[model samples]
Target: MNIQELLVTGTRLLKEKEIPTPRLDSEVLLANRLSKDRVYFLSHGDERVLPEVERSFLQDIQRRSRLEPVAYITGKKEFMGLELEVDPHVLIPRPDTEILVEAAMDMLKEKTGFVHVLDIGTGSGAIAISLTRYLPQVKVTAVDIDPHALKTAKKNADKMGVADRIQFVWSDCFQNVEGIFDAIVSNPPYIDREEMKGLDANVVEFEPVKALYGGEDGLDFYREIARQAPGHLKKGGSSSLRSGVPRPRRSEGSWKKSVLDP
Candidate 1:
């Protein structure tokens, strides 16, 4: 079938399956399969898709019909304007987490000399690598409990040309980490256990559970970060916890404010 006809059928199928942004998602998946840009598909609607390419597109459509995320199928997601490889091993980077990156950049820009940053639960290395890319002089130490996630993050860092600036470590939280950092930023797992049951099957069943669950109250990781961050953060430096109100916890030593995500 021609591009236009395939897109129409795909959209209808996606909508019937209750997939959000049916038309857009269908086009993107098709464009990726064709190894062409979305605009190319739009401008060449009359062009015919080869038999093999058409079969691939149909397969993707079947997956989408099951509410699977397009990023997982394509094996990539764009973050901070950089394409990063993604899979079931790591949580797909979200736009909300971009706020964390912006907050980190602001703090890093004000400091002079060497600045060290640590990204806890550095899935896909999106947070750590993006910070390193923006702050060339800054050194980043990213830690993840999962070795598979670290492997994926390293690959993304290498692809984004910031592999040298960032260090990937396999550690559960701050157990194996050393050295002080000017800033410690993390978009750690904050979703409560009960909330897990309500999440879409594609996310709850497919995405990494370790990267999503934050324990009973959804504050386990935050509590750990608060307790250990003072030892790692440089004197007067900041550590932003991406969560709600500040939970009461003992401060380690010197760090400044610990702002919560609003």
Candidate 2:
């Protein structure tokens, strides 16, 4: 079958299955099977796909039809122009969290001496590694409660050639963590248990539940971080909370919360 025919069929199948971005997903799957870029597929739509290529494309379509994320099928995701290896072990890096990184960068701008950063629940090591890549001289330490997540994050750090610059720790929150940091940043799980039922099937069924559900009220991790952060933050440092309302705790009284300027 030619690329055009395959794309049309794939799109129809995906649409029938109620998948979002059907055409784009079909194009990406086909291009991957052909070892070509989406632009190449567009330019060479008339080119015939080999029998083996057609089979592979069909397999990918079947996976997508079952609501598997395209990134999981492709084994890679683009974040901040960096190609990151992804798997079921870690949550996929997202664009919205780039705002957290931007906020961290802005906070780092006014400081002169060496900066230390702690990334809690460091799935995929995206935050820590990106900070290390951009800042270069900053010291980064990332902790993940899940060992599998830590492994995946370490692989990404090594692939990106920044493994030596960031430290990976296995711990539940700050249980095993030590040392003061210039900044602590995290995009921890904040989805409430009650809200899980409303999430997409792909997310609720396929993505790691431990990485998504943040307990009954979704403020468990945030509250813990806020309570423990001051002990690890340098005197003039800051902790950047991405989203969600942190449950108030008595231990967080020493730290002042400042709203970042937009």
Q: Top lDDT: which candidate number?
A: 1
lDDT of 2 by residue, 1-262 (tens): 8999999999999999999899999999987777788999757889988999899888999999999999999888888778888888888888878888988988987789778899998998889888888887777899998898899899999999899989999989899899989999998887887788889888877788888888887767776776787779888888876664343332133123311211
Q: Where does candidate 1 clash, by residue pair?
A: none
lDDT of 1 at 171: 89
Q: Residue 85 CA error for candidate 1 (Å)? A: 0.4
Please give the lDDT score at residue 135 for candidate 2.
84
Candidate 1 matches the true fold with a TM-score of: 0.92
**Reference-based lDDT, each prediction:** 0.85, 0.84
TM-scores of the models, in the order given: 0.92, 0.91
Superposed model 1: Cα runs more than 4 Å off: 244-262
lDDT of 1 by residue, 1-262 (tens): 9999999999999999989889999999998998888999758999999999899998999998997889998998999988899999999999878888988898889999878889999999999989888888788999999899999999999998999989899889999999998899998887777787788888987799888888887777877787688778778888765653232232222122343321
RMSD of each: 3.9, 4.0
Q: After superposition, how far is residue 112 of candidate 1 from its true place, in Å?
A: 0.9
Give the C-alpha miss distance for residue 128 in model 1, angstroms: 0.8
Model 1 misses residue 103 by how many Å?
0.9
